[model samples]
Target: MSKWNPEQDGTLYRMMQEVVASAGGSVRGVLWYQGCSDCNPDEAPTYMSRFRAMVDRWREDCGSERLPFLTVQLNRYTAPNPTPEADACWGAVREQQRRAAREIPHVAVVPALDCPLSDEIHNSPAGNLLIGERLARAALSEVYGRPVHCRAPEIAAARLTSPDPAAAEPTIEPTIELTFDYVAGYLLHTGSLERVFTAEDDAGLIPVKQCEIVGPRTIKLTLTRAVRGESRLHGAYERNPVAHLPLDSDTYMPLLGFYGFPISGAQYDENR
Candidate 1:
């Protein structure tokens, strides 16, 4: 019954067409929530491309070029012992889902990192309700043109703002300032923020000493040491990270999880 897979005889697609025909030969939007099976090393990397292709095919079949597609970002799976590669694949799929929302037109993604799991990979009743509400909000705003606040907070930019360019070494402390978009009011967190944000240089993971909300949409992360080569910043970037994710103070929408965002002023080489 998984919608991600099309039957060999095109049963699922035919079913969709039949449903549309029953509904006066027109459809509103699509709410997609299945991606667990695709969360593997072989499928994660090409998720976005495959997703885009599917969306394109669906829209064409449905006779709409700009159909709204509301996607729920994959929630955490915590039952079976997951390997390092498995964890990475989960993160990769989530990031690709987020990217799909950003790069594809009329596509939107809702955060489910905070949703409770019914089992290893399924959402609990309450979690499903929350996801349903989020999808409805997205459909209203994106498809029906309702004035609703449906977008999740996303990382807009990350800048290396500290180690004060003028200050000498050894005594200097390094910091990276992250700016977020779609934040309703300010950002607030629950547990220790230290475990939520991380950085990676050519040498590997950089220890984050502290994280503080210095501005309405800004989070400043102080690193244990200065980064020399190409680096990237990650927030809640694991399969099930021990995180203190920030939420919008007003709407309480959780910030979208992200990975591998290039940190500006971190000696990043774009060519590489």
Candidate 2:
């Protein structure tokens, strides 16, 4: 049994105040490792709002509005659930944490999606080390303004290519070309690249026949057929995703988790 209520009664917040007060009410930054307790279905939905409130309150207490707040996105962990819905709870909380970096300013989320687990709920020492290094790298680049390689590749654009219209029936299969940001070197994969990505439209996940790196930062995904309507490219977006892509730099930082982009409906032309 524990006497301290970290979330319910502001125990951790008060402790933060004590530390800030002892430091004369000013600090350089803050590191947060929380939200695991809130991953339950009953509590996960409110995490983003509650997180925002806590950050705001901490800023007020520490006397800085735009202070850098670095947080660790929860590492992957789950019991074997035969049902897809059983996984949504943790996935929701993880996504909410990821959104904080995008929605808020001067904040960063250290992604840990690729880290191997020691048990059902614990990240191994190596995994923890990787997470820590990522945090430091983010602080250096985002907070200190150093020119460092810390960002994961993000989807920039996707286009659907079809066979020449002059063909009798245009029987050639269509391909989706994907472009990405932060292209310092080639994208690497241990096995088939198709295993790393998914193309989904309203019809659900479209099977990818092949994924070939056409350019240093671009990949061509050959689909089983041409698609219509809006589609999406999800890279490293799975609850558990392939973890290795290191840019050619001083520190070959791996791609962070959960990258996604929309495929515009305009890309598909029936006239083709």
Candidate 3:
């Protein structure tokens, strides 16, 4: 998203160059804060390359390839769209930003997906404080190696409870088991555990029969029906996901955004 078109109006870029050239030239890093417009469905597809290119161009202009660059992931919004798929463009942009941070060295992303918005677009003052704290933590950890815990909690492993081969006609379907990394305390739920997560396959969103936290970091999600084929698991992905336990680290930093994990039931891998 931009206030001025770069092709038709080079005014902003020219002004930026002039300012960079005229200043004492002591700039160390760049803080970027523009992408709201790119959340549109028409503009989201090309946002990654465009944003990456701009970062490269800016680095070249500033005479540094390894210059530290920090960016914020798009926060959550309650748009008119009801389905997560239809409302996924903004999330797509955020995913792109996260991917860039992972692929490009010396780059970091501050997640704002959990911040509450005052309006349709802008975050509330409290939300901004959370974002600012996250950004500060990212800078301190990524740039200064201060050992701050900045990463959000992510799914570390998943498993499907296999039905007993010798059992008679079973009354219950199999369940999906998930484990997470960076869990501070025990995983808590806001309401029902079923409200905090989702299970789906090609057939579409499957209703969750039951959800039980097996341990502090492991959870079992039972589906109404068995998965037909390859399926996916998601947590806090909805536009207005059921607020659950405040996932925090031992340092008390809250987990942000949504998380996805694959359940194969064959083995549990911690590398994801």
Better of 1 and 2 by lDDT: 1
For model 2, the stretches where C-alpha displacement exceeds 4 angstroms are: 1-9, 22-24, 34-50, 86-99, 163-173, 242-250, 265-272
**Model 3 alpha-carbon miss at residue 175, Å:** 2.4
For every candidate structure, what is the RMSD over all alpha carbons to the true structure, in angstroms? 3.5, 4.2, 5.0
| lDDT measured at residue 132 in model 1 versus the true structure, 0 to 100 | 92
lDDT of 3 by residue, 1-272 (tens): 34333443457777777787789765678666566677666887777777777677667777888888878776666666567653455556655676677688888776666678898778999998887887788788888889887765556666777655578875447678888776756665545767666766666677778888778777788777767666777665555555453454354443344434466763221222
Global CA lDDT of candidate 1, please?
Answer: 0.82
Write the residue-wise lDDT of candidate 2 on 1-272 in tens digits: 01123345776566766877897876899877676677666877777887787777667666889989888777666555424343445556666777788798888876676677898778899988888888898899889999876665545677777656698777556688877666556665545666566677766667778888777777788876666666776555444444443232333444444433566534553445
Return the clash pairs for model 2, or none: none
The superposed Cα distance between candidate 2 and the true structure at residue 108, in angstroms, equals 2.4
Model 1 worst lDDT window (10 residues) = 1-10
Best by lDDT: 1
Q: What is the Cα-based lDDT of residue 127 in candidate 1?
A: 95
Q: For candidate 2, give the lDDT.
A: 0.66
**lDDT, candidate 1, 26-132, per-residue tens:** 87788888677887778788788788888887888778999888999888888667686876677788888889999999999999999888887789999999999
